[model samples]
Target: MDGQLLTYLFVGISFALYIGIAIWSRAGSTKEFYVAGGGVGPIANGMATAADWMSAASFISMAGIISFMGYDGSVFLMGWTGGYVLLALLLAPYLRKFGKFTVPDFIGDRYYSNTARSVAVFCALIISFTYVAGQMRGVGVVFSRFLEVEIDTGVYIGMIIVLFYAVLGGMKGITYTQVAQYCVLIFAFMVPAIFISIQMTGNPIPMFGMGDTMASNPEVNLLDRLDGLNAELGFDKYTEGSKSMIDVIAITLALMVGTAGLPHVIVRFFTVKRVKDARKSAGYALLFIAILYVTAPAVAVFSRVNLIETVSETDYKEMPAWFTNWEDLGLIGWTDKNADGKIQYLGDGPAMEGDGNKPAFDGVSKGVNGERVIVNPSNSVNELYVDQDIMVMANPEIADLPNWVIALVAAGCLAAALSTAAGLLLVISSSVSHDLIKKMIKPDISEKGELIAARLAAVGAVVIAGYFGINPPGFVAAVVALAFGLAAASFFPAIVLGIFHKRMNKEGAIAGMVVGMGLMLFYMLKFKFHLFGGGTSEDWWFGVSPEGFGAVAMFFNFLVSLVISRFTPAPPLEVQEIVENIRIPSGAGEATH
Candidate 1:
């Protein structure tokens, strides 16, 4: 079968599987909806948690980021992996023992204030929406290129699919569906990497292939050859770092703490029957997650090397169908600079003009060489423009992999994106229905009524998520990273203090969250969106990028919480005892009181 037919087959089969699971596991009550009745086995929960954690960012964008940024992208690998360890070791077991349906639920009872819960709910909404936008954008990218639909239409399709499963089955449906998604996505990610590795280096393992010499020329080392090609193109070395040490440290720290604070991932632990299961699931999740994390760098190297070797200085008319297919989607483009018939994929300068480095196509006009014409072509000698997000998706095609492999990858990307989208939408829904409405607005709401409210809220969240996907703030990884910053600045400090500091009071937690969230938002808008008359790198505080500013905001959160807690009345004796009990290693089943 051709790539398109196979793509439909794979994606159709995966979607059918997901919908079937949703139908089979539909929630009947609030307990099933909120926590899957809290009886999930560790292995199944671990697979689900891994799927929930690895979003579009992992399957689609992280490798792509590494392909372009090279060594600078290691921050993503380190920060995210380190953050998961932080969550597993420090947060998951304790949160499970606390027996809350959501993060806001924990904050409310732990701090003895509805006000604290309200603040947490707001933070969760902001972070979840930002993160879901990235997932939806990933969905659109996949559909637009493979399914041959417009990007907006693709997002609409994704919203419908996610809404169906998320609303109908709730956590019960999403959990089991995610387990399947994990298998699909991991297989999808690994198959192409293994194929490319074997093709290039005669090695079956991608990790080994990354270090192996090229099969075509045994004397040339792979990384060394890549570095030579990069040097020839006036780009940074393939294995060298470009970002400053301080900025790297800050970003890594922010992502680590942010992982601990993420509401969606935190709620995963609550889906298990006991605290021990939560810990066990966390360990299992790390093992599952490592399968992808370890292979991403290798995929990056393979994709980048293949892209440059195939396209650079090649005649435009000789380019393959995959190039034009992506060109039609406005993801890959070329201009006839110097009126040469060959593509000049050289230079470190902007490939296209205007904001976001995106190409502004000049109608349907084609250059003398039959390449697309961009209206605002940059002065750079380079004559090619390729979006970073396309690297992983286009890798299989660039390397001339089989049609089935290409199609399988499309299905995998969808799986990775939809799993996380469902998880985030559930967070948004539960925050509204369970946290805001039931806990705060109407404490006496019936379980059936809350379920209805949760489903309705998920529908609304889907609409909003679709809008943001169509008009994304940036690409997938960048947007997701900023969401981590938001989580770190707002929720991390409050949760840590609430658990570890017995004297931490409601006033302090609430104040810390408000201030930290406000600071992070201001920094993100000012630098990322130019909302506050955005300035350049010279204007950054402490020379840290907005992506790393979360650490600074988090510091202030901790300071404010500690200072205010010292000045305020202590928490009631029971709350302090509860904090002490949460740290105990055993007897978690009875700690819920």
Candidate 2:
């Protein structure tokens, strides 16, 4: 069968499975809606948690970034995965012991202040909404390709699909749906990698294949060959890095702390039965996530090698069908600067336009005035206009894998996109309904009233998310990275201090959150969005990129909170007792409704 038919078959079946799971696990009460009634098994919850965490960034774009960034790309691998250790060891058990429906719930009750709770609610909304937009953006891209629809229409369809189960089942429905999604997505991610690995290095496992000798040419190491090829094409060495060390360390640290603080991730622990189960759930999540994380580097290696070998200096008229298909979709584009029919991947380099009549991929031209479409190559070497997001999805096609494998990748990308989108929507809905309405606006609202409100909030959040997807603020990778920075700045410090600092008053907590999160947002808006005229790297506080600035903001949060808490009055006696209880293991009982 052709690729589109196979895509329909695989993607259709995956959607069917999710819908079935949602129906079977429809939530009946507010507790069920919010935390799956705190009864989900550790193993099952772990699968859902993995699905929740391994989003479009992880499944679709990460390897692609790694493919081009080379050693500099390891920052994402370390940053995103490292925070799980912090989550498992530091925050998960304590938050699970607190037994709340949302992160704001813990902040409200633990800090014993409606104002702090309100701030937490606002921050959660910002972080979750920003994160969800990236996922929806991914959904739009995949839907546009697989379903043959415009990007906006695809985003609208994605919104409706998420609205169905997320509103119907809440966390209960989302959790089970995510478990099934995890299976489909994981299978989708690995199959192509395994196939390509064996084809290249005679190994079924991608990680091992990354280091093994090439089957096609055993005389040279696969990585060595890639490095030589990269240099020959005027790119940096494949195994070496190009970023400053401080930026790498800073970006990785920010992502790690940001991961630890993400509200959607923290909320998953609330669905389990016991504190121990929460810890185990986190451990299991790390294990499942590791499966993809380890293989991702391998995928990056293969894709980089294959892309360079296939596309560089190849004649435009002889390009593969996938190339033209993507080009027509406006994703890939080219203009021969030297008027040569062959692509020049390194058009922007020092040797271009005059040296040896240096050829160049002069980027996408509008075809206006008979010019070509505009293009953005990964590096100065402009042979490819392939966006970083297309790395993994285009992997099988690049390697000439069968149609079925390409279709399976489509299913996996959807699973990855939809799973995280559902999880983020659940958090958004709960924050508005449970945190804002039920807790703050109508403290006496009935459980039934709260549940209804939650569903309404889910609908509203979907609309907002869809809008942002259609009109994105940044690329998938950049937006997702900013979300991490927001989480790291706003939530991580407050939660960690709330658990450990008995003397931490509401005044201190609120100030820290305001300042820390405020600084991070200011930096992103000024830099990423070009608000307030424009931002320059020269204006960065200490040469930190917007992506790495979150770690700096987090430190400021800790510093501001600790300094202010020293002068402020201590928390109330009851709040102190609550904090103490969360730190222990034995007295933890069922979370109250």
Candidate 3:
């Protein structure tokens, strides 16, 4: 069968499976909708959590970024994976022991104040919405490339599919559905890695192959060969750092704390049957996540090598079919300069070019025929542009893998995107329906009525998310980075203080959240959105990127909360008891339905 037909078949089959799971696991009560009735096994919950954590960004863009950044990219691998350790050890079990449906549920009751809950809900919405938009866009990118549809149409279709399952099954359906998604995405990611590893290093194991000698040139190790290519191309060394050590430390810390703080991730633990199960599930989740994380660097190296060998200095007119197809979709572009009819694959990446505001354009001069010269005697060839998000999805095509493998990749991309989007939609809906409406606005709402409200809220959330996907505010990386920062500043300090510090009061927690979140937002807007004339790195308080700004803001939150709580009245006696109870390992009980 043709590639398009194969893609349709694969995607169609995956959709059918998701819909079937939804039908079978339709939530019957508030408990089921909110936390799958708190009966999930550790292995199953872990797989679901992995699917929830590994969005389109992890599956699609991470390897691509790693391929380009080389050694500097290890920050993502360390930061994202390391954060789970924090989540498992510092947060997950304690929160699960608290036995609440939402993060705000714990905060509200722990502080004995609805005000604290409201602040938690606000933070949750910001973080969840920011993250969900990227997942929806991921779905669109895959569909647009594979199915030949417009991006807007792809998002609309994704929104419909999410609506079908997420609205009907809630957390119950999503959890089971994610189990299947994890299998599909992991398989899709590994197939190409195994193929490329064997092809390049003559070793089938990607992790081992990464350290093995190269098949093409046995004189040097694979990484050394990569370093040579990068140096020759004016790029950073493959195994050498590009960022300042301070910046790397800050970004990694932010990602770590932010992962622990993210409400969507924290809420996953509430679905488990016991406190021990929650901790066990975190270990399982890490194992599943690590499978992808460990293999990604190998994929990155292989793709980078393949791209250089296949395209560099080669005639553009004789380029492969995948190259033309991607170019037609505007993901990749090229204009030969110097009249050489060849592509220039060697150069510093986007961060090194231009005036830090515009794309780099090397040749704008006109030729004898009045045509723009794409290349000149200066060896300027700025005609090629490749979207980093396309790197992983396009890897199979780049390596000349089987068309059926390409189809499987398309299906896997959809699974990753849709699974994360569903999880976030659930978070948004619960914040609105459970925390905002039922808890505050209508305390006496019937269980059935509240269920209806939750489903309706989900529809609204998905609709808004779909619009963002159709018209993303910025690139995937920027928006996702913002999500982590918001979570880190707003949720992490508040929850940690509430659990560990008995003196923490509602006033201090609320004040700290507002200030920390507000500060991070102001900085991001000022620097990233040019809200204040595009503040340069020199103007940064500590040379922090907006993404890394969260860690700094989080520290301020901790300071403000700890210091201010000393001056305020201690939390109520009952609230102190609740905190003490959550910390204890014994007397673990089931969450009341």
Which candidate leads in lDDT?
1
lDDT score at residue 499, model 3, on the 0-100 scale: 79
- 288-356: candidate 3 lDDT, tens digit per residue: 999999999998888888877777777776788888677655566565556677777657445322212
lDDT digits (tens) for residues 190-238 of candidate 2:
9999999999999998999999999998887899999999888777888
lDDT for 559 in candidate 2 is 92
Question: Alpha carbon lDDT of residue 485, candidate 2?
Answer: 95
* Model 1: worst 10 consecutive residues (lDDT sum): 348-357
Return the lDDT, model 2, position 306: 90
Show the lowest summed lDDT stretch of 10 residues, model 2: 351-360
Error of 3 at 41 (Å): 1.0
Worst 10 residues of 3 by lDDT: 352-361
For model 1, the local distance difference test gives 0.91
For model 1, residues 204-305, the per-residue Cα lDDT tens digits are: 999999999999999988889999999999888989987889899999898899888999999999888888899999999999999999999999999999
lDDT at 195, model 3 = 89
For model 1, the stretches where C-alpha displacement exceeds 4 angstroms are 350-355, 590-593
Report clash pairs, candidate 1: none
